[model samples]
Target: MSQFNLTINQKKYDVDVDPQMPLLWVIRDIIGLTGTKYGCGIAQCGACTIHFDGKAMRSCVLPISNVGDAKITTIEGLSDDGSHPTQVAWKEMDVPQCGYCQAGQIMAAVDLINKKPNPSDEDIHRGMTNVCRCGTYNRIKSAIKLAAEGGKS
Candidate 1:
């Protein structure tokens, strides 16, 4: 085990873990932040998504050693009261069905908007590849649009 300093959600955490351990375990098990889920241990599924240095990253495949000094942001960090534009838009649009993938979806959505403030429909389709088993793609798109509009919904 090695000691590593992680800045997550604007808070600093010092943890002792194997450098090769996946970030998802470090966040969910060691840090006790469960919002970042475990879907596929690989990067194929977006359920383990988080923002690393303001970029969307799949935590499930990201090793602690690879994290380096980047600041991490999970869904919990997006807003304290769930009032972020994405969160608000999601609620307004009722975008979750099973809700298992919503956190990753939201993280990806926020990143998408950050990259393209006025994202076109193609932009949304290209940027958001997070899988939602509940088939909430329509609602997710609507929420993303609403969020891009500054939560006007």
Candidate 2:
């Protein structure tokens, strides 16, 4: 086991684990942060999405050794009270259905908006590849739009 120092949600964590262990397990099991879910174990699914130094990353396939000193941000770190624009828009648009994928969705949405402050529908469609089993794509789109507009809608 190797020691890793991770800075998540502005908090520092020192953990001793296998270098090949996926960040998803470290976050959920070791660190006890369950907001980032485990989906397809592989990186294809976005359920394990998190912010890796302000960019969206799939945690399930990312080994702890690959994390290095980059700052990580999970859903729990996005906002203390769920006041983030994307989060607010999510609630206003009632985006989630099963809600299993919402955290990853929101994280991806935040990254999208950060890159394109006013993202076009095409941009959203292209940027948000996160899978939603409940088929809430329309609502997710609406929420993204609202968030792009600073949650005005």
Report lDDT per candidate. Answer: 0.92, 0.94
lDDT winner: 2
For candidate 2, give the lDDT.
0.94
Give the per-residue lDDT digits (tens) of candidate 2, residues 1-153.
999999999999999999999999999999999999999998887999999999999999999999999999999998899998899999999998889999999999999999998889999999999999999999999999999887331
lDDT of 1: 0.92
Candidate 2 has which clashing residue pairs, if any?
none
- The RMSD of every model to the true structure, in order and in angstroms, is 1.6, 1.6
Clashes of each: 0, 0
Worst 10 residues of 1 by lDDT: 144-153
Candidate 1 local Cα displacement, residue 24, angstroms:
0.8
Query: In candidate 2, where is summed lDDT lowest over 10 consecutive residues?
Result: 144-153
Clash count for candidate 2 is: 0
lDDT of 1 by residue, 3-99 (tens): 9999999999999999999999999999999999999898887999999999999999888999888999999999899989999999999999889
